[model samples]
Target: MGNLCAGASPATDETIASADPVERALAIAKRDLAKGAGKWQELYSYDRSKLLGSGAYAQVVKATRKGTQKSYATKIIKKGQYDKSVVIKEIAISNILSEHPNCTKLIEVYEDKANYYLVMELVSGGMMFDRIVKKGHYSEKEAAEAMAVLLSFVSFMHAKGIIDRDLKPDNILLSDDTDSAIIKIIDFGTGEFMKEGQTLSAGIGTAQYMAPEVFKGKYDQRADIWSLGVIMYILLVGFMPFGGKNDAAIEKAVLRGKYALEGEEWDEVSDEAKDMVRSMLQSDPDKRATLQQLQAHPWFAAAASASESAAKGTRMVSRLRGFLASTRLKRLAMLVVASNFKAEEVDQLRELFVTADTNKNNLVDFNELRTALSKLGRAVDETELRRLFDAADMDGSGELDYREFVAALVGQDVVERCTTARHGAFKDMDADGDGYLTPEEVLKMMPPGSTLEEAQEMVKAADKDGDGRLDLNELEILLKN
Candidate 1:
């Protein structure tokens, strides 16, 4: 989310002078009740007094527990509203993620007379977008702290088979307590479930924070990584790294990969911090850093260390083991395995298997398989092809079964090699003790006589969406070309 929501209301309004921006915004939001912004009468049992906030597609209201005064945020979605599929998806995703600590907890859900109402915890703190604007970029330590909390939350969501397609500063909420502010990611209205080999074809999310591949209409959870990078950059810099005057210019600049970070503004920030942002903002999801990899980053090392240290005692260890054994952990492990495969490759393989297995015998002979691979420029000899068949034939049945073949190919290593190479490149790119690659480090990787402008040009070229950072794909592509 951008700062468009910021200062929309006057700061000195007496009604909200003592209240934070969130409270003020909630109050302003209640004004919509007079306009009858949504068809709330049918779905909700209460009247306008409980209304909270109203946005383009949904409205959040204060709903009291059936028998108690305890209040929760109830997000009401009319069935025939803005986008039905997206609304239902958001509801389902919120329900699925209700149990995770980092994610906003959903209290209860009910449908009445054609509308869906999702009850969730209401954090009193203002939006993260407000915090970034007010604070004007955080220090590396502050950024890392916020990121650690966000990463943990995102990791949990991914574990639950949910991809928060829209991850931005506004979607993230800061708790009222400033010292130990918990980052709760809300607004799952654009989220989607990712099954084995699932690839989202629709383009979604705020443009500036979106991944480059999203512009092409084919993306996965790695899209979240792109958004994460954007958020990280904003946390480090007061403005968006990919800002433009209009959507068209921004889109063109992004596709052409135009971006830069020079001058005194970026001097105080460490190279390692920049490098992490660069890697996360990679244009290609294939080359983006994994959540686990992000967690291991030095920027996050402190938090990681603290988390590890916190689990040292016997009671903590027992709890840790139990957590690892929980359904969430098991699902996360499965997601880690599934996330490795590229969406494009899986889609292609799906089509190939469907076409080649015309006999309906559920298996493809060696010749048929070889022919299919050949079309994709992956021709293999009889022995290698047989090995491929055997590897895919988990049942040990010599023949290459369709289901087994698809399953085998869906593994991370099989569908993509970008991640494998990115690890080596990241180490080489980070020449300094700092965890990131500076323009100087990036220049060092180039040929001799490459002017600063040339280096800057290359960086911009590789950025592939003007997001001021480079991912492994852009780096490799720029260097290779």
Candidate 2:
């Protein structure tokens, strides 16, 4: 038997080696670490400090990459204790929504003999509940705007066929410590993709946010809309729509849709907002407001217009840059933060990022950035400038890439120059005329300190097929994304 196994063909031997779970996992992790340039290396490169938190089956730790200085929340799960299928599914779902501004993106996944490590975006800011607590009381208009953003995100997910079975204030996180930071929906462990006419039968979700249909073991994506209603209610009035001394009681209240707006907090809230909540909290899933209907409602329309007006009024590049400098957010996280700013605000900052490109190399060095900021009247001291520039120069490139610059100053969602210069840039990275960019070629093209694994992950994300290489079509799709 041993001789037979050993004599297996190359492909068969590869398959047999991977049949042992530990060996399979170790191979994946080591292969990733060896690359030293991809997100996979993010796990090995980062120095883990204190434990961030623990869940029912996993624990998260705070980590900072050695060379890049980027921080990430690494969620470590014991491999033997959980369902591998569920973990894989959750990772896939997280990756699908990773680039969404309002989701806690899954940066990378790794495994060892005993544990599965999920490296994800670390939101330094606490939960939405914590924010509301810190403020003592929140304005109705602010709550309305937050809901608008949340609803927009959920709408985006539904359009992509994803359903966030879990939605609550605790799962909703503010992107940063700032009051105006974007709100992100986190913890997509219960999220699933559904096809047209499909209904989920799983009884999953927190009791308070659980739609009544969930108790009956039949539900659809609309269940998420109902949870949003509960969240909207709590956002306006600092309390849950359904509450009791025990889980059973809370579940009962949720099932019955037992909630009232009788409180000092609700005294000042508009009836229109309350009516909107009522529509969303409908006991019947069919009667509930879809994301489209919710957005088209007068409440969101008014609140959205108000938010746009507020954003327009504060569209000063100086103020925006000052905010960026103050936050001290990671360069990657800065991109998400930037996405929240108005286009005019981003356009003005683009001039700065461009002006900082003194050598016209499309990359900005520390001194060039400092000079540009000084010319713009936002001068920073040598120490602060060095710190800020270092943080933004991911990959230890010594200079900021265009995406990094936009992330630091412009905004997260701003298109990279690569979109317009696609072919030239793609060809430049291709190096050889091999029709495909190999790992070695990709590593050379990326910034310093970037891992070969990171480049591989980029290719994998855009590869579409299971092929290990990218073609021009794939490159365009990746650039657009």
Best candidate per TM-score, number?
A: 2
Residue range 199-263, candidate 2, lDDT tens digits: 98888888888899988888888999999998888777667889888878887888877788765
C-alpha positional error of residue 73 in candidate 1 after TM-score superposition, expressed in Å: 1.1
Model number with the top lDDT:
2
Q: How many clashes does the backbone of model 2 have? A: 10
What overall lDDT, based on C-alpha atoms, would model 2 receive against the true structure? 0.67
Model 1 deviation from the true structure expressed as Cα RMSD, one decimal place = 23.9
lDDT by residue for model 1 (1-481), tens: 2232231343234644544433443333333222233443433455566566787656887766655666677887655434433443455566667677777886655554455667789887768887766554665567788988888888988876678878999888877737368888888888777875688988778888877788888888888988898898888766787877887677666676555555434644567777898889777678889999998887665433333222122111122222223332122222233334455646755665676676667787767766655554344456745655654444455666644455444323232344543345455566764554446666664446766665565456456767655555554443222
Candidate 2 segments exceeding 4 Å error: 1-49, 304-481
Q: Which whole-number lDDT from 0 to 100 does residue 47 have in model 2?
A: 39
Error of 2 at 96 (Å): 0.9
Clashes of each: 5, 10
**Residue pair clashes in candidate 1:** 254-465, 257-464, 257-465, 272-435, 272-436
